[model samples]
Target chain A: MSAVWSITKKELVSYFTSPIAYIVIAIFILLSGFFFYSLVWWFNTQAMQMAQNPYYFQQININQMVFAPLFHNLSIILLLMLPVVSMRLFSEEKKMGTEELLFTSPVSVIQIILGKYLAALIVLLAMLVLSAIPTIFTFVHGNPEPVPYLLGYLGLFLLGAAFLALGIFWSALTENQIVSAVLTFGTLLLFWVLSWAAYSARGLWQDVLNYLSFFEHFDGMTKGILDTSDLVYYLSFAFFGLFLTHSVIQFRRWR
Target chain B: MIETEQLTKKYGDLVAIQNLSFRVEEGRIWGLLGPNAAGKTTTMRILTGYLPATSGRASVAGYDVFEQAEAVKQSIGYLPETVPLYPEMTVESYLGFVAEIKKVPAARKKAAVDRAVQIAGLQSVRKRLIRNISRGYKQRTGIAQALIHNPRVVILDEPTIGLDPAQIKEIRDLIKSLKGEHTVMLSTHILAEVKEVCDGVVIINEGKLMASGSLEELARSFSQNDGVYLKLDRADGEVLNLFRQLPGLKEAALDGAEIRLEWPWGQDLRTQVLKLCLDKRLEIREMRSLAMNIEELYLRIVSGGMEQ
Candidate 1:
């Protein structure tokens, strides 16, 4: 456990020492802030126009009007940005020859992998925390339900973790950071469009594609529905990605 | 402290190291001598548990490299051919991280780092970022990282490879100083390095072990037939004939007032030649017996002059 923390500390220090952490966090905030501002603007315009109608105005819940769409937009932004955060985790180690040192140390492979994964997750968590600052305005000015709003953030975090795990798997495949980032983006994009493909399909194929799609599992969480099935899907996706990464690293040693 | 038996590694069809075997007793310095692509790096990687062998057994500090890898890793410290370092880390922090992972107790981590820093002469650059330091200092920092845990066996692959002469000397001295406390195995293609620092040598070429023994044992075994150089004031053809007439003198040739003689090993012909010189009234200016240095021994063994 101490070995895992040692690797995590070293990785965190490296991320901050370089410009990568600050740049990624800054870009995420800028983009999420833009999305939040535009969504709130649209929500205000609709709320004002519907003021004369009692029934429609009563249905104008801030949770549905502003926060839901914002959470969905934040997930897209995370999908685009988390790859950059995870691209260098393993690629830089192989390129710089530091993998030899890590493997030859007393630590196990699982420990090293978890340490790096946790560091990237911490960076993801920081971005989520900073982006929440804009959401705090909704709580102060309007009466948005706190439970569903927090659940949306939880959904975003799980989705981001799943993205990071796949990114880490790609990073372990090659020594070039650009290659790792592009491959992660391409694979995530494919997973994103699986549900679109499911729309044209029929029967069991549609059900399978919908189940495998990253979009389906995240939908319930944004609506404040705590389904065990969605939780299982995200956690299993992350575990499978980490398992593949471990196999890749272990295979290289024998080869 | 370290031993390998029939250690073999293959990548698909190409064999990196084949049936290689050697040993390093406790408190001794052994050199793995081979030229480029001689599987020196492959052998070191296998013994360090960074790579597994296809077939064979290896152990470090009484722990099998494959079966008990964690124990073996904890007991040995290795510096790969390329010094692995994080450029963003300070020398001090890098050693501290290594100590932590190497399982040095929390209370003693700082002391271990300090001891390694002092031993590797890294005090001057301990606080500086690794990328900002010189190459020599970076190499020393790599050495410091390896020693921070104070393991029983320290394996370094080409430790002095890219340093200047003075830096090489300093690194060599540091390696030599690890003799009594740590069993050290260093790999190099430079014969002079083996001569200078190593007590024994394991020579390999093309992934095959050519020879392994102490320096003197190798020299003696390969230099069974010795030679002598005689410089005299009057080394005419008649003097050469007189020297050649002595029994057990294999061959004597004259060239410009000098005569060269060859004889079997362990034969002392100096007195007989001196007697002949005195009887012939020849003035001997210089007389010396030629002893084989590491260069000749290494060349002979690597060039296939001696059978495996």
Candidate 2:
């Protein structure tokens, strides 16, 4: 356990010292701010229209109108950007031959994968925390219930963790960081776009694809409705990704 | 102590190494001598538990590498050929990370890291980022990481391939200084490194064990038949005949003023030749002994194995 934590701690330090940490954090905060302001501006426009014409009042829920879109857009940004942090987890180690040091150490393969994943998760969580400042501003000025923001943050975190695990698996699959990043993006994009297939498909197939899509699972929480099934889905996705990562690591030594 | 029995590793249809067996006693510096693609690195990887053998077995300090890998890894420190290092990390932090994962007790972790830093001579640049350091310092940092936990066996693959003479000597001296406290096994194609530091050697060619033994013993074994160079002041065809006349001298070749006396490696014909020289009243300016050094032994053994 200490071995795992030690690896995690080292990885975290590695992230903090590297320029990538600052780059990713700055990009995320800037993008989240952009998404937040856009949602606020659109909501203000609708409110003005309603004020000018009483019949134009759409009876829109503020949480659903502003917080939901902001949460969803931020999740998309996190999906696209977290790969930068996660792509180097195992890929860079293999390229630089540092995997030799890692595997030859007293730590186990599972420990290394978990350590790297946890470290990426922690960094991603920090980025999320910073990105949430805009949401906090909304809670203060927009006068919406904090429940949606809190729930949406939880949803975003789980979604980020699941994506990070997937990125870790791809990183372990290849030594090229570019390849890992591209594959992670493509895979996450596929998950992001699965709703399209669900929308066009027949009943049973649509239901299955909708259930499998990450956006579907994350949607319930972002809308301020907590579901055990959604949590189970993310936990399972993360576990499956981590399990595959472990197998890649184990097979790498044999090969 | 380290031991391997009939170890084999195959990549697809290609065998990286096969039927390899060797042993190193506790607290001895052993060298793994081989040419490129001779499986030196592969064998080290296996013994260090970075890779598993396709067949056979290896044990380090009473722990089977495959069965008790964590214990073996815990006890052995391995520096791969490329010197696995994180360029973004500082030398001290890298060693500290190694110490933590290597299970150096938390109480002694600082002391252990400090000892390794001192031993590897990384004090001045301990706080500098590894990428900002010179290649020599990077190599020293690699050595420091491997030695941080004071493991019983430290395996180094080509520890001094591209260093300057001074750095090579420093690394060699550092390895030599670990004599009784650590069982060190270093791999290299440089015979001079083995001659200078290793207590014993294991020579492999094309993934197969060719020869292995104590330094002097290995040299003498492969050097069974050698040539003696003789420079005579009264040098001529007559001297060549004089050299050939000595019984047990297999053949004689003339090169400028020197008469080359070819004989079996174990045979010492100096006394017989000196007596014959006195009888003939020949003025002997220089007589080279008919014994093989490590270079000749390595060339002969490697070439001999290649031919077979």
Candidate 3:
């Protein structure tokens, strides 16, 4: 609908025109390049040492040994950067009082949430594309399976979508951008680190906590396994975040 | 048209508006006058579909505010107290976005934005970012954004509250120009604005309606008698005594060179008072009817000096 497009375009314009987008992209690419270069360099040195012995039984596939770890490291980098990128989605609107125009407009609340969340998704997509430069060098310099790297990228995209949605949820809950960013980071960190606590637990509780961890599925996708359950988990997680955001905005109308 | 029946909005334990009701007929400029904390904005928010009322029913442009909110929103343009705007956007782009969200068709969006910019007199600063414009221009941009949709009903909350005198007059004239084509309701604490621009007014205080009628009707309903003021060159005790003899004279008081007298309701003692001054050889310096204006009526009503 035109209403959603209008808001989405406006939000995208705001994001790119300011220095926030440029700074976030710059930082994400810089960190991702460092990790990628280090991972590939380390993988090469390990491969060379193994070449010294022709009787080595285990094979070192460059995709898993190098590019998979690169994807995993870049996901961690996105975890730190995406929250800041999405922090202004609704918090800035509240700070600027533009929420009044939004609420009074004929546009539905879901359209607004979707529009803003999509714009953040676009920003993350841009970061992913730009950061893929170093990975492209991996293909030119060495033979890495394309499907595995693509799967890792897909997994990162899904995780980024869910993280950005949750960031927007936090942004809608407050008018302070820093508070939104901080809270988003805290919540996402809990999901990323929850698997660590599973190690100390036993039986069903451990399995439940491990399954709840976002990386549990992200790790599976990074290894080139396209599981439907993992895809459903990430999609449903993003939907639940979006649903809560829509409800928060609707509830404010009653106040 | 806009109508409400016993509309009430409560913020938890505090009642923002209580059992308030009023109507805005088609294509008329109406004023909602109240002091600070009088729930003017709260009422406007409900009508604009920005906030839901706690109780009772309200409708805008024939659509229920709560049930048919999307329809109501599509038919109304709202300018809030804070003048909601994206400071980063240009005036032209901001109006364009408003037009788009208000569902103006693709082919007509440019024309709609241009019309709104012209109506708000924002042509000179159409390309300027909202953050860089002056306060008056920003206010006009707010009005332009509200009117871009060309809704039948437009609600502006304190459109001239923080503007300079020149800006205030300009904005008032802009609102007055919409008398016949667009139904407008502007809330303000300035009584003179209502008298100059509004065809009818709804005065409230502490979230309750004090009076709702045209200027003359409200004044007449609050006053016991019509009043007049006369300044005579020789306004001595004898001059006051001569004026008291006029027919329909209810009460007469002389203070310095000014003599203000009250007469029976709907009585025009102007000719009689003039004839008496001519007969007594009293030179009249200044003479004007001091019919109870909106200022006194509002003070009297809000202060509970008049019976509701």
DockQ for every model comes to: 0.79, 0.70, 0.76
Rank candidates, DockQ, best first.
Answer: 1, 3, 2
As for DockQ, the candidate ahead, 1 or 2, is: 1
CA deviation > 4 Å runs, candidate 3 = B234-281, B305-307
lDDT of 2 by residue, B194-250 (tens): 989999998898899988778767756654566678888777776777677789988
For model 3 chain B, give the 10-residue run with minimal summed lDDT. B299-308
Clashes of each: 0, 2, 0
Residue lDDT tens for model 1, A155-223:
999999999999999999999999999999999999999999999999999999999999898888888
User: Model 1 off-target regions past 4 Å?
Assistant: B225-289
The pairs that clash in candidate 2 are B224-B265, B225-B265
TM-score of each: 0.93, 0.90, 0.94
State the displacement of the C-alpha of residue B98, model 3, in Å, after optimal TM-score superposition: 0.7
A76-97 in candidate 3: lDDT tens per residue?
Answer: 8888998899899999989988
Task: Name the weakest run of 10 consecutive residues (lDDT summed) in model 1 chain B.
Answer: B219-228
Q: lDDT of each structure?
A: 0.91, 0.89, 0.89
* Chain A TM-score for each of the predictions: 0.98, 0.94, 0.96
What is the C-alpha lDDT profile of model 3 across B48-144, one tens digit per residue? 9889899989998999999999999999999999989888889998898999889999999999988999999998999999989999999999999
Error of 2 at B38 (Å): 1.1
Candidate 1 lDDT by residue in tens digits, B1-308:
88899999898999988898888889999999988999999999988899999999999889999999999999888998889999999999999999998999999999999999999999889999999999999999989888999999999999999899999999999999999999999999988999999999999988889989888777668666677789988777787888889999888997556788878877878889899889988888998665578888788888964546
Model 2 global lDDT (CA atoms, 0 to 1)? 0.89
